[model samples]
Target: MKVGLFIPCFVNELYPHVAMATLELLEGYGVDVAYPMEQSCCGQPLANNGDSSGACDAALRFTGVFKDFDYVVAPSGSCVSHVTHHYPWYIADNADFQRLQPRVFEIVEFLQDVLKVDKLPKPVHFPHKVSIHQSCHGLRELHHASPSELMIPYQSRLERILQLVDGIEIGQPERRDECCGFGGTFSVDEADVSVAMGRDRVAQHEATGAEYIVGADPSCLMHMGGIIRHNGRAIRPLHVVEILTGRGGAA
Candidate 1:
């Protein structure tokens, strides 16, 4: 399948190698992947911050850059969730974007739903106990797994894929679907609460004896990573794709 990759702002600027692992994994699958430099933010930050006008502009630009691809995929669940759920709010009745919306996917869902991938890379091996931190957007918005509020049963697409990785043992914290408190603008606007939430979430994961914490979206991991660093903890944070590529958290 032809793919257009959308790198979230933070991943593009700060965690570039993590971004490369994501791109490389898709390419490794023999899928034709394109990274459009013309791409910008998914308008999530703008929209989340109550700037619908700016978000609309970003939305249009995103559409202009990715509309032609068979699938528009992003390493970020939060960003893709915004596009899938909120983009139409600004561009009311825009047929072009509406048609493209369903084709867009967050990377994990794209892998589970599109590629039907049944295993990790042939040579991938991550021999460590890691806990999964579910990104709120990916979990609640995209339905990545069964939310704690639901009585329904479900499976995590990301975890299922990770289960196929050799020598990789994936675990979960006490609260499976709790947010990492990095709700985009929510972190900045509610600093104390965000950190408290992060601390609590990290503590739960740490209790699992996990040497590393991994998740489909790095934004959530990034928040918890900060808490880990500040507290001088040894737990490492990583994108699932990084482990899937056998790259680990290497520089």
Candidate 2:
């Protein structure tokens, strides 16, 4: 299948390795993935800030860049959710463009749903207890919670894939689907509330006695990881894709 890689602005600039790991994982699964260098932000930052016009321009640019791909996949769930959900709302007039929204899949969802590999290319070992933080966009917006009804508010394809990895024990947080306080602009605008929420989330993870925290979206991990580091805690954060790519390590 022909797939286009959509690297969010933050992933391209700040978390390039996450994107790289995603590409490596897809290619290892014998999938044909292409990176459109012209692709930039998914226009989520603008849209979340209530600037729909600016977001529309960015959305048009994004749509123009990957319109021909069979599927658009991204490592960051929030970015994928933004393009798939928000873009159409911003550009409702373009019927053809709106159709492409459903074609976009977060990396984990694509791997589990499209690839459906019975066995992973390699074994991953993380001999430590780990807690997972579910990002709001991937959880609520993208309906990442639909797979499992176990008390956890969001159940993602990534969590299912992680179960296949060897020696990794996935634990749960206090509030399964609570926000990690990394709502893009929400963090900057409401600094105190953001930190408070993050601190609370980290505390719950700590209570789990887990060595690290993991999640599908890097933005939430980035925020909570920073708080964990600031407090000099031993627990670290990692992306779920990083684990699936067989690159599991502390933070």
Candidate 3:
């Protein structure tokens, strides 16, 4: 299928490898993925900051870039959630664009739901216990948890994908669904609360004695990661897509 690859601004800049892995994973699954170099922000930052007008320009740019594709997929659930969930609210007056929002899908959701990729990348050995921090957007907004509730007693596509990686023990965190306090602009505006929440999240992960905390959202990971690093902690945060794509470590 022809797919438009939407790389969020931070993913393009700081986590380029995650985007790279996304491409590789899609291509490996026989998807005809194309990147529109002209694609820019999904305007989530501006929208979250209560500036819908600023978001409109970016949304228009985004819609123009990926409108032709059958599906728009991104590695970020938060970004996809913004476009699919929030963009409609921003452009409620524009009936044309509101209908287009449903075409967007977060990468894992696309792979699991649409493509139904049962076989994944060859398992890589990490040999360490790791905890998972489910990003709020991915879990709650995107309904990643819904499938688990329906299909089985307990199941996470993220955890199941991680299990494909050899020697990686998935540890359960104290409050698995709690936010890491990195609500994009929330981190900068409420520095103390942000750090405190991150510290608490890290402490819970550390309590599990896991070497790494893994999740799909990089923004949350980066926030908690900074706290983990600042306090001289050994725990590290990793993106679930990175781990699934077998690009988890420094190369």
Candidate 4:
């Protein structure tokens, strides 16, 4: 299958290595992939900020860029959630979005659901104890993990995927489903609250004796990581695909 890569703007510009790792992971699975340079924001920020017109412009551009691919896969559940769930709010009645939205999938979901992945990188040595930080979008919107509220029992797709790797131990934070407080613009408008929430999450993960915090969303990691660094803590925030791709320094 020819997959079109959709790296969120922040991932593209700030966390380029994560984007590269995602691509590398997919290629390692022997899937055909394409990264179109024209792709940009899925207008998530604009839509989150209630700027419909601006969001519409961005969504239209995104739809145009990945419209032709068999699948539009992104490393971020947050971005994919925005594009898949919110584009209709901005575009209202556009055909471009209708054509592209159904084919969009977050990388992990694509690998597990579409590709039926059963293994990960071999000869990888990751000895650190790591905790999973389920991004809100990934958890609730995508149901990447079974939420505490759900009566139906379902395993976390992420944790299972992580287990595919060798020499890795996974831990769950004290409160598994809580937000990291980086609700996109939530950090900017409510800086203190965001920081406190991030600090709380970092502390919870630290209590698990985890040296690294891994999640599907870099945005959450970037937020929690800032507070982690400011407090002189050694906790590392990483994207899961980084681990699977055997990105250098991961071991």
Candidate 5:
């Protein structure tokens, strides 16, 4: 299958290693993965900021760039959720949008549900105490992990994926699936509220005694990471793909 890698704009610019780790993880599975140079932002920020015209243009551009692939996989849950859930409103009459809607997936969900990866192809080891931070989009929209509010039996694709790695002990935070206060434009619109929420989330992760805060979404990590760095906290942020490929390092 031809899988197109949809790297989010922030991740592409700020955390290139996360993109590299994602590519490495997919390629490790022997899947045919391609990064389309024509790919750009999925129009989430524009849509969030009430720029409907610009967002619609970006939506069309996204479908045009990635519609040919059998599957469009992104490491970011927010972007995938936007493409899957919101793009229809932007490109309701576009055939490509309809065709590609069900084809896009966040990387963790892609591996667990679509790829059905029970274990890694090779023995991957990451001897670290890590905690899972479920992004709001990944938790609520994509259902990557069971939300605490749902009151259902707890389950996390992120934790399950981490279990596949040798010597990796998964720790649950006090609020296991809480948001890291990085709701794209939400962070910018409410800077004080965002940082306050981020500090609380980071403190919970630190309470787990985890050395790394591993999450599927880089946006959440980036938000909490700033809090950790600003406070001189020992816990570091990591992307799930990095742990899967044994590449988590100061990300």
Candidate 6:
């Protein structure tokens, strides 16, 4: 099946390697992946900021750019969640929107659910402690992991995917599903509150003695990585694709 690779604008600009890693990982599975150069934002920022007109334009552009693919996959859960759940606000849930809805998928869910990837085609040997950071959209919208409030038996698609690595040990934080405070435009509007939440998340991960904090969203990783560097902390923030592709991290 032909797949379209949708790299969020933040990831394309700030973390291009993550996009490359995602492409590499998918190509390894023998899936035909295409990256449309005309692609832009998924209108998440505009929608979050209440600019309905601007967001509608973006939503239309995104649909035109990616409508032909059988599946549109991105490494970020937030962007994918926005396209699947929020796009209907700007664009009608007509034939195009309905077809695109089920076709769009976050990389983790695409790999686990669609591809049925139990393990990597090539084995990865990380040999380090990693704490999983469940981003708000990934946790609540995509249902990547069972939220703590539900009080159900804990389960994580991210954790399960990481377990496939040869020597990786999973670390648990005190507050497992708390947000990193990088809620799209939320971080910029409330910088002080955002920094405080990020610091608290960093401290929680540090308490577990994890060397790396991994998650599906680069926005979350970027937020925590800045805080970790400023505080001279030992923890490293990594996009989950970095580990899965075994590229440019403590391997």
| Candidate achieving the largest lDDT | 6
lDDT of 6 by residue, 145-197 (tens): 99998978788999999988888999878899898888777898999999999
Regions of candidate 3 where Cα sits further than 4 Å from its true position: 93-99, 146-155
The C-alpha RMSD of each candidate to the native structure, in angstroms, is 1.2, 2.2, 2.6, 1.4, 1.2, 1.2
Tens digit of per-residue lDDT, candidate 1, span 159-203: 887887878788889988788888877888998999999999999
Q: In model 6, how large is the Cα lDDT of residue 200?
A: 98
lDDT of 4 by residue, 142-217 (tens): 8999987788887898899888878888999998889999999999999999999999999999999988999999
**How do the candidates rank by lDDT, highest first?**
6, 5, 4, 1, 3, 2
- Model 5 gets an lDDT of 0.89
Give the alpha-carbon lDDT of every model: 0.86, 0.83, 0.83, 0.88, 0.89, 0.91
lDDT of 3 at 205: 91
Clashing pairs in 4: none
Instruction: Output the lDDT of residue 111, model 4.
Output: 93
Top TM-score prediction, candidate number: 6
Model 1 lDDT on a 0 to 1 scale: 0.86
Model 5 clashing-pair count? 0
Poorest 10 consecutive residues of model 6 by lDDT? 242-251
Clashing residue pairs in candidate 2 are 145-155
Can you give the TM-score per candidate against the true fold?
0.96, 0.93, 0.91, 0.96, 0.97, 0.97
lDDT: which is higher, 3 or 6?
6
Residue ranges of candidate 4 with Cα displaced over 4 Å:
121-123
TM-score winner, 4 or 6: 6
